[model samples]
Target: MTDDRCFRIDEMDLDELRDRTRDQTLIDAFSNWIRNFAPHVDEVIAEISAAFANNKLRDGIGLFEATGLDDYASDEELRRLRASDEKLDWKRISTADLSRCYCSPSFFDPQGFVFHLPAFLIAELNDEHPYGFIDRIYRTEEHPEGWRALLTNKQRVAIIAVLELIREHPDYQHELDDIDASLERFRGAQSMG
Candidate 1:
């Protein structure tokens, strides 16, 4: 018998990310956003390199910061990120490694955020527990005051799509207030573009 029951986005298998399953519209939106923003591996790498060169990585405690012995990321997680950048494959990152990016939105400058954004989007659509992903959307004040302004129109639109996705998800009903607040801010930003 066919498994006709609907599944939550976070409950699907990783391979099903593009399988036209439940939440396909959100998946396609995220995929299109990734393709539009991070179309080239070289460009992505260049952005990451610029962030590193410009000291744009953020000043707050990152997901990996102060990990005396209990590190949030693997010792090789950074290397894996570099590898993924070279390959343009978000799936190369393990869930734990993806958490490092999603959990610490303040750790990335605007450019760095752009670089890792696809991963955040993918994790949001797939990970069972995407820690801090929701906060990343609504905790706009945690980032530099000018951060939102630095994002390109396409990037802002991508964020808007994700916000809407979360706002409509039943699991996120409790976060409606914060999601609505962020939606307004982002929509306002979009209009100014």
Candidate 2:
């Protein structure tokens, strides 16, 4: 395998991954992956921008908020939406498990695959630094998969933080909590593959 295709299992750290995957290369990869899966972020921005141009910013925000997407809109974006004439630099929020920005799954993949942001995230965290779970005692019959094992407290927290950021609507908070609780049953597998 090419070196780029290879990763050191020895260099893994959960704390680092939990806070933010310390590997920029991996982060960039995740950034691409997340953006690929969630195109609506941009779409929402476009709609908001169009509304502002039409001098209907308030109506636009209210309309989008009804769609349950206003929370993900950045403060600057919201401000700009309200103040259409204000010259402000509004940065788009990049979200998802891979990106440092916490995000919940807006929906599942069309192929009916379960969204595995936490799984992919833990796997990436394992690849990024040493002292990761792969080399630790968690591997065994309880976690024969080496990389996979029962979710640790830290892992749950990390995953939950990601979920808190991404949501279909603010009201879906309870559903996300339920999903997180359900995920507690799995081993910490290294990769989605």
Candidate 3:
């Protein structure tokens, strides 16, 4: 006996057809799309986050070396670094700059990493926020440090998501072009200073 009855489709309205057609074939197609596309987007984000983290580490190391400060440098030393009279090249400094001088476990925490970033650099990052929360938090004076902490967390998450996308779809690597453009803009601003 033939199984032709399994393939029969009665006439139906658009909505009815859509409802009835939600079968294994449709479900499998949706699943395939997610499997194929989601990862590429995620990979891009993760790579970006890793890049940012690496950059932070580099900045912290540079700071320690330039200042000749030990990891246990006193708060006085840190204050002096932040002071205008120190003539510190804030623009050229980064989280890595601080790492060389400090051995604190908190220093490596990605969320606390923002503390190593100069206020101005943080401002730039906020300026590029795809969401308004970064700008809003940065602008508010109620709790500057807290705001930075929040932003650091938010950025880390966003970058990780992008990395996941990149990982999923190597073919869509070009999706990083926009991120590159944004980075170029930031770099240009730095050069101008």
Candidate 4:
């Protein structure tokens, strides 16, 4: 009789053969293989978005309130002051985790993901910073996979509200071109003041 141990490959069930060999090591190996082949591009996109959002908030406020001029000032002077405030300091804030101050599922990715931004960072960005601040985080985009920002749409609107307030402030003014520059100037002014 033929030896049962030396079974023919064609006689085995492919599904059963695959299932019998599965384990943590195999799973890990597959994950590593996939990661190596398809590195996380979403990470880079999220980082860029984070930097952009942070800068936007900082500069928007700075430009709106840089002139040191108030309601009593002339329109031309207000325009110039706004232009000056448009410069901001992009590097002044760090991307720390801030999950404690405010908790909302909106900040989570629709696909179910996680991220953290420190409350101190948010406070510093919106409260302590010159010009004005956004007390909440803003989420700009989402992916089908799993990735999330510390901010959400509602939070972004809240920030925009603060920006609008800064714009309407008797001493405030806003300009588009000077937005980036204003953040830089404000960072410097904040450091000095």
Two-way TM-score contest, 1 vs 2, winner: 1
| Reference-based TM-score, model 1 | 0.51
Residues 50-78, candidate 2: write the lDDT tens digits. 32222211222222221223256676664
**Which candidate number would show the highest TM-score if scored against the true structure?**
1
User: How well is each residue in 1-193 modelled by candidate 1, as lDDT tens digits?
Assistant: 1122111322243245556557776665545444443233234334433332322223322233323113355657744543333223333545666554443455555555544555555554544334655457576464635566766666667667666655654455678888888889889988899
The residue pairs found clashing in candidate 1 are none
Better of 1 and 3 by lDDT: 1
lDDT of 4 at 14: 28
In the range 1-193, model 3's lDDT, one tens digit per residue, is 1112111112222234346566665444334434565334334434444444433332232333224343555777755653421123333543343333333212323333343333223322322212212222222232223423333444444433433333333232344554444334334433443
lDDT of 3 at 60: 34
TM-score of 3: 0.25
Candidate 3 residue-wise lDDT at 163: 33
Off by over 4 Å in 3: 1-70, 84-91, 94-105, 108-112, 115-149, 152-157, 162-193
Top lDDT model: 1
lDDT of each: 0.50, 0.30, 0.35, 0.32
Residue 161, candidate 2: alpha-carbon lDDT: 35
Shift of residue 192 alpha carbon in model 2, Å: 45
